[model samples]
Target: MLSVSGDVSASTNFTLAQIQALPANTQTVSFGSGTGQQTHVYTGASVWTLLNQVGIATNPAVKNDVLGKYVVATGSDNYRAVFPMGELSPDFGNRGNQVVYAETLNGTSAALTSTDGPLRVTAPGDIKGGRYVSNLAKLEVHTATSTATATGGGVTTQFQLSGAIAHPATYDLAALQALPAVTRTIGANTYTGVSLWDLINASGIQTSATVKNDLLGFYLVATGSDGYRTVISLGELSPDFGNQPDIVAYSMNGAPLPGTGFARLVIPNDGKAGGYVSNLVALEVVSAPR
Candidate 1:
């Protein structure tokens, strides 16, 4: 049985038959494994579609509130992986992650082995299989809640980078502009600033080299001056995985962002502006619980 819970209008469980009944999509993907790289073809329903069917609750008052949420996929062995809502939303990251029961391994209808799974979660975009959790058993969704309260003031001139890292530091507007600039465009607007991945890399994420694909289980939270927080899985931004070109923009259309702030998050492909955190204040990196 696979159970789904957390922040949904209705929580539910599903059997293998039921899961296969939902809209099915087939994908051919390859990822690194113990033996080396392996490729497979899978058919299953999109995680985003499943969330929508169960009714993901979002604050209508908050702009793109769903972007602040995340989904946790747990296997029967208690192995877990996290996916941010923004990464799953068709209008945003458009990632086609799935909960699959059928597969073609090595061009054979081998399906899933009895020991491996009757159900498994697959991330087609990942270069490694770390996020492709097998024997899937549960999924829980939660908001990346923040306690920081908004202060009535002028636009923010700085932001802090702190969390599980070797170097925890803060940066002002001038310091941010000094980093290598990465420019991205959405619609008619062009944003120029540093890449979020660059900032995290500079902070030196704390992880064990012995653990294979350990970084895939990490994530980061971006908080705005208004206290609104949004989650983004580390894998989503890693060039080795999702490869999203998200930037902490300081300027738009070659002009300073006076109304927004000296800096803001810009998710280039987001259909909504919710994850585009304005008046950026803090970026906290986190390692998801094992």
Candidate 2:
């Protein structure tokens, strides 16, 4: 099985049929012996398409944080090769059909050799196939951090946004509720605050046109006053923009917290509160390196 994880709103484990179900592209790239190299046809989905489906940062605004990210493809034999996120994205830098998770070799009517696939990753541009891994089993992102730890939290009284953002923005209880309101139910309680994306938008960190291709590496790191931390993708928090589930709460059950916790982060549709953190103190939007 070929699966996807990391820095995404939803993780997808793909079967052969499932992989084939996605948009497919056919490319003719050179692949043969040194004495007489020959061309071969590859049919598979684009890395950019897959990255977008699973939620990667593709906006132009987050490039400073998007650059240097990479993807790690691990094969069944445990062999792995790294592909820079920039090299696989249209906006960043992808040449021809340079990187593809090839499912069909020769033609759609021909099956990949037993050793070649169920699913194999091929870089058509390489003179040697050392990085063209076969029997691919997993693909995941790795984040690279270039920023120092943020300061000024000695006695935090509000919420803060950091990471891939252009300028850090802070929000008090009133400021949080002032943006917009969305009420959602979790178990037996109802909670309210602006969606987490609202706070992100206010922070000036955004998905710009050119940055969209290399977005999957960015994340929303939520930390609480009690040291409990939870991570979520920026995609899930974007409404009409990405997927669902971006909420921060100032009121529980239609009212403020009971003499405790200034605010809460709630992810709806989940049965547990593991990712739903309370007493939120900080939200960082750092990029993940490949």
Candidate 3:
């Protein structure tokens, strides 16, 4: 049994069950948003918990480190949300209260619309509606690191960029157009008029020494106030002048961009698509070149 809380708007509020029927570990659910208030329901259990129940040597060490991961809840409306790993873990129990399946909501049997219902996710402490997807469609658990072993071998030496953006009054398009040219492009878009380096350099975030020590690879994962996500690989961050393009976010008609309530990644090199990074959140320097 897990407790969940969320609000759809100023007038609508929700506090419901976080898991559903099936079995302890064999259930699955989907979540997304729709018209009116966003709803969260449960569908079935998941293999994740089944592995846990069977005592299959689940990633005990890493399981204890859920704070570094993210949970994606999807709904039938195609709406989705993301919850940090920290919110799902239990404080006093062997594991965090994170349950992938449930049976009811608000003391009632959980139900959903043909298009949206029958399943959902309830991350009790998550405040973002985007994190509480309704329609109840999918439950995906991703490990952010490649070397993330269930035991102590999962740790990696990497550079972590943690910081905030000032949510500019307006993106200086003219200023961006005036900057010098960049040396590379990553995807297929061209940000020919802006100086991305200047933006990163000016951001007050602390850049760990690891960023400069090794040019292994970079990754960027961006999330919206809604549960939308986008991933940018190392090359996409720093594109080569041809087909690859650098990532440049634009506000609606240049209105000040909303503050990234959550931090997104920004890598300068490596060619790869960028969108909805499920597991790997940001850039990591796996190893330096010899």
Candidate 4:
């Protein structure tokens, strides 16, 4: 049994038990004025406990870093909010301190017709009402990966990309044509050229012996020295005129490539761009195992 007490700017208030009765994994936290109040005191259960109760398992390998993730809570009304992962973990020591789902209010349950009632997300205690997500209908946990890539015939763990390279901030036609190729490797995987593979592979997707040959995709958002971004796809990785794509780096250059840093992925392929893709800050990969 769970209990909560707080003032909301709504015509009514809700309680934990009332929330639990609406959906198995659904929980709500309410705040704001008009239909609700602007004050922030959410009643609901901890997100961690709810996840465990719902049997949605987190990967054991990355459990320690789970606090760095985020939860995207959405409502039936299409309203949404993002909560940082750290707020819901053991860092707070209160099992019920994480995001909460509210169903009842003001000692009375909300009727089905009430738009403000039925469900909402109560943010962690430390967060203010501006952070609390009211009228939440769906909660999704999103793990942030620096990069994603295919490996062992499947996608491997995502990783962060960062490095220094000798090149101008932007490339003109002559600069793009004259730039030297860069090479890098991670674990047994090596990449030569300019494909976003390194970014994809860095995205923290683990692969086991049983799973391989998976097609992988990554969103390579390269920010220039001046804050310009260029997005490239896997197909665009092949070299131009030659077998390799112009934008990718390749071993054909006949030199040893740099080793990928700790928890990093090596990008392979070729690119005609002159600017070296150093200082990579973010990577994301989504894939299915073969």
Candidate 5:
């Protein structure tokens, strides 16, 4: 059985038969394995669909409150992985992650082996299988601090970049412009700034590279002057993984961000603007709780 709990309107357990009944979703995925690279088709239900069924709680008064939430998926063997709400939401990252119970290989329907499981978590967008947790056991949703208020008025000139890093530094507009520039075109406007991946690397992630999958469970929180906060999974922004081109844009249409701020967090692929935090003030790196 799979147990679901944490910050949800309903907490329940579902058996394999019940999970297989919730609108079957099929995905063809390729990832690295012990032998070599392998590909297979997985069948299950969307994680987003399951979260909705249980109802993730959010504050109606808080702007984009759901963006600050995340879910931790734990396997029976104690293996774990995390998925930020932004990455799973249809309005935002829309990654289409699945909780699979069956596999299809070379046109043959195969039941998931006991070693792999009757239930497994699969992230099709990930370049690696580190997050493809097997023998699924629990799903817990968690909300970060959300005390957003009206904009603090005026353009922000500087913001602190701290949390889980070797060197927590303060960056101003000029400091941002000095780093390598990455340009992106969004609809009619053009944005130029530093890649979020580069920015994080500059501070140096404190995780041990030798420790396998240590960084997979880490995420970043971007906060605006208004206290608006949004959580982004580190895997979602890594070039070797999800590879989404998120940036901290300082200039738009070749001009300094006018009233918005000196810098802004831009998620180019979001279907909605909830993750676009303007008047950027702080960025914090955090690890998912065990």
Candidate 6:
């Protein structure tokens, strides 16, 4: 059995047969003699699918925390390697590159050699077999401390974004305004800034078929400077879905505003101002608890 840990809702153990039961992918790789001619087909499960089974955020739009995330694949011999989650994330532009937990080598009925596997990683596009971990014993998902940095454009960004994404980006007033403009009239105020959806995309979370399929589990939770938080669904950010005209407000009434949270968040869809986050310290994409 293989142990999976870190950033998961619950630790899990899986047998070789169980791993094979998940969705599988196939690839051909050649390593012997370093001539790239001795090729063999590798087939196993998608790492993303495995993460999803353990409830590790898997939405394309939700994005992971800005802190960063990586997966550590270790072998029974103690050899290991780390890969950024984004490389395996479909939304991060590496769409077809799949890092799979391989069970079968060469043919459907042919299992991996005892020296190489009952399981191993079939690293996508990796020419070096160094990434092809054998006798897989554990897979640990790791996350880094989210770092928020303001652009030189006179913006001081402190808040972070996390969820099913790879990178979290911070923006200041000038930086926020630098994004595509979406001006709208809210309660007693005409706000101009980027749409909340655009801001989320700027943080590296994007819409893909996978994201659309998993929208029900996705939400945005904004933390205000006052320590208050409000959650919004991914569908709510779309016009066809909820038609919410939410935005990260930079200028109120079309005039330069001097304030603590220069780039504030406004929820025009909410009847009450309870969802209005003033001085948002953090804007995160989260997956609803399974």
lDDT of 4 by residue, 199-224 (tens): 23333334333522112121233432
Badly placed stretches (over 4 Å) of model 4 are 1-37, 40-42, 92-113, 124-128, 148-290
**RMSD for each of the candidates:** 2.5, 14.2, 17.8, 17.1, 2.1, 13.6
**Backbone atom clashes (below 3 Å) for every candidate:** 0, 23, 54, 70, 0, 10
Q: List candidate 1 stretches off by more than 4 Å.
A: 105-110, 208-212
Error of 6 at 182 (Å): 35
Model 2 lDDT tens row, 1-290:
77887655578887777677788887776644445675667777776677667886433553233433556676787666655554455643453332244534433546566776867776655544545667888888665443323233333458677777788877788777678788887778888777777777677764546543233335666666655555554433444223455588788897787643777777674444455656677887765543
Expressed as tens digits, the lDDT of each residue in 1-290 for candidate 3 is: 22121211112112223244334432222323344333444445442342233222224443233333443444555444443332232331111223333445666654454443444444332222333344555443443333222222222222233323322212333544344534333364332323433444344323245442111123233333232333222222222211123334332123422343122222223223233222222222221111
lDDT scores in order = 0.83, 0.62, 0.32, 0.35, 0.85, 0.61
Q: By the lDDT metric, which is better: model 1 or model 3?
A: 1
Q: Which residue runs of candidate 5 sit more than 4 Å off their true CA positions? A: 145-153, 208-211
Query: Candidate 3 or 6, higher TM-score?
Result: 6
lDDT of 1 by residue, 1-290 (tens): 88988989999898888887899998888988778998888888899888887899899998778877888888887777889988888877787899888877666654577656788888876777878888999988887654345656448988888888899888888898889998998898899999999889889999779766677767889888877767898888888777778899999999998698899998886677767889988888887665
**TM-score of decoy 3:** 0.32
The ten-residue window of minimal lDDT in model 5 covers 145-154
**TM per candidate:** 0.88, 0.51, 0.32, 0.36, 0.93, 0.47
Q: Which lDDT tens digits does candidate 5 get at residues 177-258?
A: 9999999888989999999988997798888676567777788889998888889878777776677899999999999987
Best by TM-score: 5
Which residue pairs does candidate 5 place in steric collision?
none
RMSD of 5: 2.1
Q: What value of lDDT does candidate 6 attain over all alpha carbons?
A: 0.61
